[model samples]
Target: MAKELLINGEVITVNANDEIVEAVAIENGKITAVGTTKEILQLQDEETRVTDLAERTLMPGIIESHIHTTMYGANVLAVSCKDPEIRTLAALLQKLKQHASTIPAGQWVRAWGFNETSIEEGRFPTREELDLVTDQHPVMVIRACGHLSAVNSEGLAIGGITRNTQNPEGGEIGRRADGEPDGRLIETAHMELYQLAAHTRDEMREAHRVASAHFAEKGITSIHDATGYGLQNIEALREDAMSGVIAQRVYAMVGALNKPEEVVRHYMQLDICTGEGDEHFKYGPVKMFLDGSSSGPTVWTTAPYTSDSGNYGIHYLAQEELDALFIPAHEKGWQVTAHAQGDAAIDQLLNTIEKALQLHPREDARHRIEHAGLVREDQLQRMKALGVIPTPNPTFFSEYGDGYVTNYGDRAQRMYPLASYYRNGIPATITADCPVADFNPMRGIHSAMTRKAPSGQVIGEDEQIRLLQAIRGYTLHAANASFSEKETGSIEVGKFADLVILDRSILSAEVDEILGIKTDRTIIGGETVYLRSKEPVNV
Candidate 1:
């Protein structure tokens, strides 16, 4: 068989020995050998292709342990409310008016990331206020929390929601002083409008394509796409992978939260999942959400929020209700990654997982807790004991830093404790949680290492992790969380040849310099798929 040799580069093989090799040999899209140039050349036949990358440092392609790729992708093309200049209802209204002109008439105009805390008015935009921007079409703007949606009267009417619409079991409709629906949907209630406007499979595949290219640019070769959005989203990704359009590997989690029967059906069809999808795709885990995001005011907090004394946050399911979903998923041999942010929610999740573990006893299950943002110390120990990986979005430090400090007060110091996880021997991985935060790994690593928020204050200095720890969180630890460490997380011999060559050394660079570390070359399956040099190298 013909062989390929990539020689003369610093290969940081994060294998057992942490081998640093000068060259590697590849055959049939997998590494055949990793050693000195001479050793790799010896194994090559006359038909072998040898390519020297000169001074580049070759390491494992990074893995984003947690993200919502489809949502992120759609957001790439959606109406964005992330503008920094808009700080008041007036400004937001003007921006929406301008945005409406850009879109075709009558199509619903949707926006995301609108936060009351950031706005001068300090409240969700009223449906009446939004109607002024566009009466000809329905307009819906989501709170930055993803747990709430502010809709114009037109939008409310289109969704069949009325003043008498009772709150759904897992969701709420904000009501006026007179008991009329306020056009603000909370928690699961927002799903009614969202589901109606959800993208088709073709749109999702396109979103994945756009998202993959963006990830590749940031040196992210793999991501634990938090949930599949829907079964069609999963199917769309698979179809894209088969057609060779997916440029980054996806560790997909089935996004089945409503239909328990569908969850079981998808679990039973696990045989159809290709855990290994070339270099661009893969599948693992089945996602469930016990609660909503902290920013959303629905995260099942232990205490009432300072602003909302009447509310202790919302729970999508009770303890027993959650266990019914968790136990069966774990028993079916699927890794479970839940969206649990509040301490109360985390405690409930740990209790249920403990029971499931007692029943099944899979010590190395590597079940993950997504957005374990505010875990208690006791919860930390239990997570460590159960090998629950906490896939956190460290980038939250930069985006929602102020809100966290304002919400938790001094206790904000422990919001996303990377150091605590290290001390407890729990594997912690960081990601973008995109559509919520940007999907740049550099930004996340910098946040992990420095604990500095965009507001120029260090929110949790004591909880800051080391640079090496941050790197491993994105690479090795992330792979372990997704159960893909053996093949692709590290640059190891006899493994899939997934390599990321960076423009700068992230390990020895200054904290600020980390953000400038760009991707120079991306190799998947021993083939150079992405290169940005002015001149092409001869192979």
Candidate 2:
């Protein structure tokens, strides 16, 4: 057995009892003991490595529930367009222009993280504006929501898009007053644009490495890679993880969104479904997308947005189409999940899942609704009764809360109802959505309590949860989402030693101070994968 002991920490166990212990003992990368320093000291032998915590805080390594490993990696290496970075349309265009100037004439100039709400002009950049950046090279600037994008003339031509090019089944192409293509691609169209401007294998590998290290530095030990482009990308990611390019435990999702229909069909022939593989990498749910983004005002809403009258937003698939995809996956015993942001989309999801369950029910199969951004009182109750899990992104409160208030008015309070999830007996998991918003687990925890925008406006005061509940959402609850709770979620005697040592005590800190709390060290399986301090961690 390995020898390691940590003591004198505010150890928040996030267990059934929610205990705060003083120390923990580790053996063979699993928790061996937990209690006061003296109790843990008794378990330590002469060869054991015991380290003083010096009154720091220790908790489960933050589990980022839903993140796009490869996508976030590529976005990190792209131009900056996210709010508080490139705020004005002119400034964004200028940044793209500067980036274009450095690249070769025929190369693609890509940018990500655009927020129309946060920018000075409060609008999407036109294709013409992007052309001004550079017409010689194809340019695609994707919105932060990842639901829409605007590409230059060259890009449209490269994709064979024209005024007459019809909108795909689940996507749209922007057009000007005269019916000329305007360069904007929405939903599935953006997916096509991504395909046209796909990153190189070398580029993706390099970016994946950067993203892995970044997640480690942020104290994240586990993540769900929700959107791998196709089987090829999935294979590549698995290889990366197996080779230690990705250190964190990965719950890699399979076909539905980026995966071609044929690829999914072929996969069904395999003996495996979900929950396949080992501790390092595992197959997750059959994931799919059902609607546009709430912040993009393209969410499939039952009520028209307050900001856009007579427009109820977009639903990517019909009930029949969703059933064809989901019912098969559910029947096959794979956990099913979809990106349903608005009430209308969630409604569609509930209907289909209910039908699938009626056909063949698995009591323990926790089908999930990702980004249930907006849900009514009735929907929440239905979710609890049907045993559907709602995985919401609390960090969106910091990035899109003001826009939600502006677009939905009082109805915005229904978005990401964390407190209501608990009251209704649902263990709603929380996510940061990474490239869509801030990825820090601390920011997600803070958003759960405040429900505030960067402007300090609390959009949903009634939905705010307590600090401990928020902590649970990111730790044990997150692990439960992937069926890995028994192995890694808490500080139990047999759980993996996936723990984060923080510079300050989040349990004792004021609500606002939580965001500033940095991770001093991140340990996974008794190994220090990341350490902020340079000093020796000796016995």
| Predictions in order: lDDT | 0.76, 0.85
The C-alpha TM-scores of every prediction are 0.89, 0.96
- lDDT, model 1: 0.76
lDDT of 1 at 440: 79
The residue ranges of model 1 lying beyond 4 angstroms of the native Cα positions read 1-10, 17-27, 35-56, 84-106, 256-283, 306-311, 537-539
Q: Give the per-residue lDDT digits (tens) of candidate 2, residues 178-234.
A: 999898998888887777687778877887898999999889998888764777667
Clashes of 1: 1
Model 1 sits at a Cα RMSD from the real structure of: 3.1
- Model 1: how far residue 278 lies from native, Å: 7.3
Give the worst 10-residue stretch by lDDT in candidate 2: 255-264
